[model samples]
Target: MANYQEHAFTHSGLLADIPVTLLAKPADLTAMISRFGNLGDAIDACEYWYGPYPYDRVGYVLTTDGALEIPTNVAYPQFMTTQTTGNNRGLYTHELGHHWWGDKVTPYVHNDMWLKEGPAEYSGHLIEEWIGGQAGLLQAVKDNHFRVLREAHLDDGGFQPLSPMPDEHIYGTHTYYKGASVMHNLRGYLGDELFRQGMRGVQIALAEQTMTPQQFRDSLESATGVDLDAFFDAWVFAPGYSVFVVRERTVNAVNDSFEVVLNIDQKLRGTTVYHEAVPLEVSFLNAEGEEFLADIVASGANALHTVMVPFEPALVVLNRHNRLNQARTANERTLIPGVSFGSTQPFVDMIMYQTNLVDTTLVRIEHIWSGAGVDPATPDVIDVSDTHYWDIGGLWPEGTILRGRFTYAGATADNLDNALVDGDETGMLMVHRETPLDPWAPYPDQTVLAGDLANGNGIVNLDVMRKGQYAFAKSSVNVGMAEVRTDLATVDLFPVPAMDHVNVQLDGGLNGTVRFDVLNAAGQLQMRTFRSANAEGRYRLDVADLAPGAYLLHTAIGEGTAVVARPFTVTR
Candidate 1:
């Protein structure tokens, strides 16, 4: 039997452990421990800012069905798992953060849900960053952005006032992503330490009590010792995102640096003017691979400023992380090589996956290409001449390989001509000829005449294709294969730089059973496995327990066997 009573004990500020009952089985003991540990970490994080844990005898229960329920005495979860992926851990962390931000410092009503939901959501993200790192945090933000953009209806007018409850369908947008975005903006405005202090103050003020959003705001102001009305008005109540465009840039020969200006535009669309300090990151890379970074702030629309940074950069990129949606003159450029026959299938697949589809009465085929990193001089080089969509030329950078498949109508030979390249145009295009599939391959005389579009003659149809059908593009590129050197020889692990979890696809090569171990930068082991004659397949290993820091996965197949090591990360 497991010590269920001890695991359920809630620690007060003074470290007093109260006896409690365990409402789970022995197999669930590990999960119970993890939950308690998370709860303890949340308590510590909150206390580091506020004061200390204010409650006693806190109970955590796992509910088989329904959403999470957080009461003053207990937290009942609708789901619990140690699988390391999905929203389960995040949801758990957010609910635990509510112990400090909502349950303790209660939000008076549902209208001011931001007070309860925003901080909690922000806390979950913070915890994710702690365990998953920068990539994980950025991915979480991206997921939130995508979710809100897909579900929320901006035309319904800017965010609904924090008083009336909006429809639950909009919950993911209004209460989660938008709310978290506001908190994130506020954190940027007040700085990390000050913002944390403000959070602590709010918790202390509402200890064992309830407060309105205004009261919480007042507490934050008092704690941070700064005014935040503008911050609140712009983020908490605003709709849509701020757009920043790179207007112009100039290089200074004397200093061997560049001066760039950014134009911030606001599309309020009849909404109140948003006034909040926005931080922007600018990056410039020179021909020699040298890079320089500069940070700037924009307080409102039409805010223009110039900053001089070291290095006569060949390319300048803004918002490198895509943190904000903006139209910039100097967006990142990509090289797309002209496509021809005998090109690598993976390369063709990549082009097809990236290209947008243009359909007309002429033909129907998939088009894949990338616009990012396109050379500005040749902004519209991939022109479709004599074609219905002549204006459909895509942006391509120098040295980029372009690959795609084209099927010509069997009866009508299409004239697919390659346009001549000029000084302004410097990229290759490779087009593959695909035969129409036979409805009955083994059956004789079972073929169909597929329509095709030729040079300036037949109609052409270009449709955006989905991914996964093509092979890995970079594999066949001249970029050279990635060097795989390992001190260990007997074990092999693939799919390096994986997202969620690392799969230990063991092959016991020559050596019998292998021992797999994953260690962090601090030389701390995260996971260990002992396999016997393992096949060449995926073996899931959870890395969510490990912090965002770097880690090494070492596999020892057998005696006199080689040890293979790989680096992997867990992204939320």
Candidate 2:
């Protein structure tokens, strides 16, 4: 518990007719009252979204360290000088949000603390978004989501439900992060109008009272005229997080459109069955360029769903914005060989690994090319535990046959890359047309062109030109082809140690709009701009006004998944 000194200077301001005051120590009197004016505006912002401030007098005290909200007054640690106040304002807004959520509509018991903390935290993020725009909101959400995920990974004491208050020591992320995420998702599920109406209704109905999780859900349902029982049960009362993967896929082309069938598997171990209304944003791509966007939903385990698109999709991306709370984000999408290009010719990459419990260290990796009147050739033998890359040009064209065989030294050897064939084990093969930008796991939705076991020796029979050649190799191989088309690696930006401005030059071969986002060292978006590449695909940027410091420039070409990141500095 913290005690405030009685001897202090006070300044008063009107927060939309609601009297507000700032109390501070003698030495800090000037800075406190100066930034106190912004507190008034923060109150106004909260009131605009959450309705009127419940307390008549809002007082904030600047103290030594940390902060706490006690009814009408909040104790803040840092003295707000003009230079630092902008960064600390979020704390003020969050504490002020408690005036509505914590002080007025308090939770009846400790178990329901989410009613107090969840909305307050979410309000803080929402206020940042409102004040700073979409970029700010995205940064806030990504930061929070990453924190929650870190916490989730660290919790080895086992899972607990997010309601009725779990044990205090184990109550960190589930209470603050998971709760806030639930509110954020609920708002998305309810839409702007209904979510706003429901939130306002909850505030108005519970003012000067306490609410349990059920009561809050009831108020929202009553206001929005929608049944959210499933939503509450799975997200709020559930234990484990939702993890989904694409188990299988099938694609069929019809005229200018293609039909996609996806089998999504939800693998959350435990006795609890987690139900989710998975929101998906699908991006369709073709030779004409980035085509269009479509939204779809999948639910439950083994969610088999089909979607039709207006264009022949060269590539399809799911959960583009990363909206789902996926435990294993890998295998979210797969390339349809025949659909990516209207050809049967196969373009493939493979990784091979030697089994740990092997009788011999030597292993042979052989690729057999046959078909289209091309005679089958002898297998190329490569012996190693490390990564190897192979490129077969026009000889293995459309309708060509390709087979990958791994030979173990001994006749009793179980498999070519013999060992326990689990996702976690090495010697597992993964196929990809080109190496992905991010690590193999986090961005697994679309990497697979075709995959086969190293023990079985992978096999693929090319369909037509539309059916592309596939890649196969042992999993965990960090190698990619050097010839993959894309200027992601060749993107050039300078002056490295720039004072005024820097320029970014892309290969004229790179077509489409490139979004450039510049951020400070703290990962806060400093400036966001874009440039469009004409036929030749060339563009540049002017970054002269940025402050002198280290910064990151994130470049995403067009609407494609390819992104290039580079760090630069501005020196005085």
Candidate 3:
């Protein structure tokens, strides 16, 4: 036997043998004691609630190794202690709980292992509650419930019966999570005192001996004075679980309290639905700073229950104990929207418009606006005056449209105004004619548009034609506008080769309203017009769906244009 030691601790009374040889560092002495202190508290709580401690010596080891093993005694790794303090405490408590469920009354065969593991896991939560209050324990339980539901698979053909221990790393199933869930459900059925008594009775009856899986079940029945065969058969022997889909819920006021009625459906998929009643705790918080609690049991495929509680509830949350896995929750939020456009203008315009449509609470927008030589604030609007080109930069979901329109007026009949669009980094150009001009006409002479500028300069008036298909050129500028002659501004697209998404930064212009357009390899539009004002930030364009090819993104804010052309490939 190990040498035993007694010491005064904050959480529990009576400290047991300390095996210092297992501890590597001298500094770990205090930490080792602290860990054992928590373990002592758990043992005390379990004894007070259920029964007595069954171990003569508690062996605690701190190591950097990964696995948690029980070799005729309790063994814990040091990494657990340093990685997560709370998880370390819970793990120690759980392993210690095994002294009763696993070590004292061992499983004769590997199949009956859950009888040892499940109860010990549940005991860990109980200890967590004792140490860190009910709220902290409840949150831990909720996290575990979500993890189980998220990992469970409904298409794994055969169900893994809880009677036998399956390979731990098998795909589509996990033993520890399922076992813990089963024990939690049992606790709901037997009530706190009855469950504790049942566990203690099993430990005392089978003390210092090993039992088969069937024998463990028999002991549970004898201790609880109830038939749990059906419970075990459905939850333990069976595989898979039922997902509850809540269709609707209604709350009504009745006699100084509120009564809630919920319409729910169960989807068992390929598995048989178990006919069992599960306790659900409903919490309602009212605007008047009042809280109410109600308990209800859901048993049938289509179960309806009315829960009455004092005060009207502003918010309602179900499955407060995290005993059962739920498919739907009221707190779920919608995923981000994906939009596709057919043209660059429409795509850029859509992006700008949807910027406002997106829920501000969920997404944030950043952008930059730039144009040709004349500092975006003063863009030349004359025909072929490259000054009117605009570039808008920001991140948006793939296949989304960004749309925006700018107006320009001609200063003379010979000089016409036009709009040219292109991506910032790609340099792929798409030009559109602003006014109805004869396509066969000669190139227009030097003329100014309607904007505040020097004697030879021109301004782009906001008056735009609302009808007719505006002819636009792909990858080139259109020189067919009659009587329009102006110097085109030379803008360079940077960060040439981009993977996934590209960024556009405007160098010479005041930040103003900007728009974006995403085009596919074939120069076809996939999203509608998106727009944002004075926005400056990096924008991501998803090229995952696009084939191994090149794509273009055009950005424009006022008369400034920056084009970005990038090539990317999709790998499955």
Q: Top model by lDDT, which number?
A: 2
List ranges where model 3 is wrong by over 4 Å.
1-37, 61-73, 78-84, 152-159, 165-173, 212-218, 225-230, 243-245, 250-260, 284-289, 308-315, 321-517, 521-572
> Relative to the true structure, how large is the alpha-carbon lDDT of every model?
0.46, 0.53, 0.47
Global local distance difference test of model 2: 0.53
lDDT of 2 at 456: 32
lDDT of 2 at 177: 74
Worst 10 residues of 2 by lDDT: 369-378
- Kindly list the per-residue Cα lDDT of model 1 for residues 1-572, writing each as its tens digit: 33333244544433444334324455665665655445545444445544555555445555555444364334444346454434555665676667777777776776667777777787766765666677666666655644443334442344454334365523545676667756766766676799888877777666888887667778889998988876666555554444443434555555555565545343332235555666677666665445687777767655666777676666555566544422111112232333222322221121222332222111112212111111121221333211100001222233222223322211222221222211111111211111111110111001111111122111111222211111100001111113333654534344455555566764433434444455666544444443444355345554544456566776554541345667666545
Model 1 off-target regions past 4 Å?
A: 1-22, 25-51, 64-73, 78-86, 154-172, 253-257, 267-276, 321-398, 402-572
lDDT of 3 by residue, 1-572 (tens): 33333333233333433222234355565565655556656767667555755544455555556435363245567556454556766787777777777777887867567777776666777777787887666655655654554444422334466666564523223456566777776766676777777877888888889987667678888998977776666577776554443335688888877777867544452246554665566656565434577776656667777777677665455553444543321121122445432222321121223322242122111110111221111122222333222223222233433333333323332221223321111112223322223121111111112112212222111111111112111222212112221222222334445554345444344354333444555554432122233234333333333344454554443433443332333333
Where is model 2 more than 4 Å wrong at Cα?
1-15, 30-41, 79-87, 153-156, 247-257, 269-271, 285-291, 322-572
TM-score of each: 0.53, 0.55, 0.52
Report, for all candidates in order, the number of backbone clashes: 35, 29, 88
A best-first ranking of the candidates according to their lDDT comes to 2, 3, 1
Candidate closest to the true structure, highest TM-score: 2
lDDT for 239 (candidate 3): 64
* Root-mean-square deviation (CA) per prediction: 21.6, 18.5, 19.0
Residue 324, candidate 3: how far off, in angstroms? 3.8
